[model samples]
Target chain A: MKANIIIRLKKNILDPQGKAVHHALSDMQFGDVEEVRIGRFVEMVFNHNNREQAEEETRKICDKLLANPIMEVYDYTIED
Target chain B: MKTAVIIFPGSNCDHDIYYAFKKVLGAQTDFIWHKESNLSSYDLVVLPGGFSYGDYLRSGAIARFSPVMKEVVKHAEKGGYVVGICNGFQILTESHLLPGALHKNVHRKFVCRDVYLRVENNRSVFTGLCREREVLSIPIAHGDGNYYCDEDTLRELEENAQILFRYSNEKGETDRRFNPNGSVANIAGVINKSGNVLGMMPHPERRVESLLKHDDGLKILKSLVNGISGN
Candidate 1:
């Protein structure tokens, strides 16, 4: 099974990197940029024979390693 | 005092901390490699500042899993003193030994300069020698020192008096610009709930000498020594 994990900073937290990108777009004369938020995209392949079990295990992985609970929120989807 | 400085592969400030202990406090210092698992004999273990593991992926992320940290955690649980500085602070947070996490600087730049830090708490083992609210000049150099924690955790820290240091102006007033990083509450350092483990963004080892000008860093180290020696 393959899993795709999307992790991003919580909305309440400031996204300085994204803000910097917003500024750079305006500076480069591309004024159409309205918003940009930076986030992490993680793709993983799991060898579990059961798809449901694989998704559960992947969620554990997300909680333990992929995202820090203090500042980030993550969601994962498994594909067979 | 018997002190050990944990040496990671890319730790550049290990020697600086070692020297500060040896010369300033006349401490018996040992260098423990990151791969070592034993740390029972040391009165204090220091995770010095540096670009540990080249700060790959995230600052101090990889270094937190080193074999030495297992022993460090055990020692801390046993009431042993632990101080993490700069990259060391990152490792402590990564290891879950301390609360919160360090994000990229607010300015998105690596800042390296002397700044004033006010002592928030002087009763802990880390800062017993300093007066409460006194400001001292210390140097900081890091790209990801912006501290972040949830509001509840921040309240817990404040209620428990775990906050140790806060950045301030020369006159000892809290200054947002002097904060350098957008740390919540301008917190520069904090002790663990148990109050034995300390993690701070500023480098006290860098300010232990008169030649460094304003050797106020010694006040904190002296407090540690007094705590260990029961002086």
Candidate 2:
């Protein structure tokens, strides 16, 4: 099984890197952009063949190490 | 007093802290590797600043899982003194030994310079020698030092007087103009609820010597020495 995870800062949290890129884009004549938020993507391979077990383990990994509950949220999908 | 400075891979400030405690303060100190698990004999355990694990996967994220961190947690839970400076502060937050998290600087730039810090709570073992509201000049060097926490956690920290230091002007005014990293409430340092663990972004170890033209950092180390001796 393989798990693909995407992590993002909470909606209310400020994303300074995204903001800087937004400003850079505006300066380059791309003025239509309203906002930009940055996030992280992670890919992991699990040896388990059970879809249910892989999903459960992926959730645990996200909660424990992949995403910080203080400022980030994460979601993932599992496929074999 | 005895001190142990834990050295994670890529920790560049470990020697500075060791010198501050051993050579400057005349306290016995040792460098503990990240894989060592026993910290039962030290009076103080320090986590120094640096780009640990290359600051990959977020600052302090990877270093928090080092084999020694389990013992660090056990040490703090037993009321042992622990101080996390800069990157060390990030590790404490990742380990959940301290509340809140450190985000990237608001300007998305690495900031390095001297900043004034107002001692918010002098009653902590980490600041017992300092006068309340006294402004100290310390150096902070990092890209991610902005501190953030939920409103409820902020309220609890305030109500419990857990805040140890706040960015401020030379006169001790905590205005937004003096906030170097956009930390919430201008918080530069905080103590855990039990008052045993301290996490701060500023590098007191870097400012401890008069050769550096600033000895303000000595007060923090001296206070810890006094606290341990008095205990």
Candidate 3:
């Protein structure tokens, strides 16, 4: 199975790097730039037969190794 | 006293903190790697500052997930003393071990200079040796030291007296310009709700020698020694 995780800064937390990028986009003449918040993308390959098990494992990864709950939010999708 | 300095892969200040504990404070200090899961023997566990994991996503972001941090969280939960400095502060925030988050400096620059701090509350174990409102000069080097939390959290922090230090001038005035990263209310350091964990952006280890200053950082360490000895 292949899993793709998308992690982002929690809402209400200031995203300075994203804000800087938003400014740069405006400087480059990109019109209608509403907002930009950077996030992490992690792709992992796991051999699993059960969807529930994969999700449980992924949550552990987020809590224990991948995403920081204090500053990030993550969601993962699996493809077989 | 037996102390341990948690060493993340890119930690640059672990040796500095260790030297401060060993030579200045005359404590037996050990450098624990980030992968270690044991922390039961040390009286003090220090998360020294550096660009852990190259600070790739965010300062201390990747390091928050290090193997040793799991032990750190457990240690803090048990009322063990933990101090996170600079990147260590960022890690504590990233790990949810402390309230608030660090954003980039409002000026968008990596500031590196000595900054003055007002010891806000000396009742905690970390600042027990310092007088209330005493001013100490310490160096800060970081891009994401601006701390932010909601109004309610800030109110609780103040009400609980969890605030440990604030950025200030030599005369002890809260000068905005002296606030290197535009931290909220000029907060430089804070203890956790339980008062067992202290996270701060300033590098106290850098000021532990008389050659550096009057070794004001020594006083803080002494306070920890006193706390461990149950004095």
Retained true contacts (fraction), each candidate: 0.47, 0.71, 0.24
| TM-score of model number 3, chain B | 0.97
How well does chain A score by TM in each candidate?
A: 0.88, 0.94, 0.89
TM-score of 3: 0.87
lDDT (tens digit, per residue) of candidate 2 on A1-80? 99999999999899999999999999999999999999999999987789999998889888888899999999888889
Question: Higher-DockQ candidate among 1 and 3?
Answer: 1
Order of candidates by DockQ, top first? 2, 1, 3
Candidate 2 wrong stretches, greater than 4 Å: none
Residue range B55-166, candidate 1, lDDT tens digits: 8757888898899999999999998999999999999998899999998888888989998999888889888888878888899998899999989999999999999999
Task: Please report the candidate that would top lDDT against the real structure.
Answer: 2
Clashes of each: 0, 0, 0
- Which has the better TM-score: candidate 1, or candidate 2? 2
Interface RMSD, all candidates in order, equals: 1.3, 0.6, 2.8
Q: In order, what DockQ does each candidate have?
A: 0.61, 0.85, 0.32
Better of 2 and 3 by DockQ: 2
- Candidate 1 runs further than 4 Å off: A47-49
lDDT of 3 by residue, A1-80 (tens): 77889988888667777889999999999869989998889998887767777778888987766775655789999877
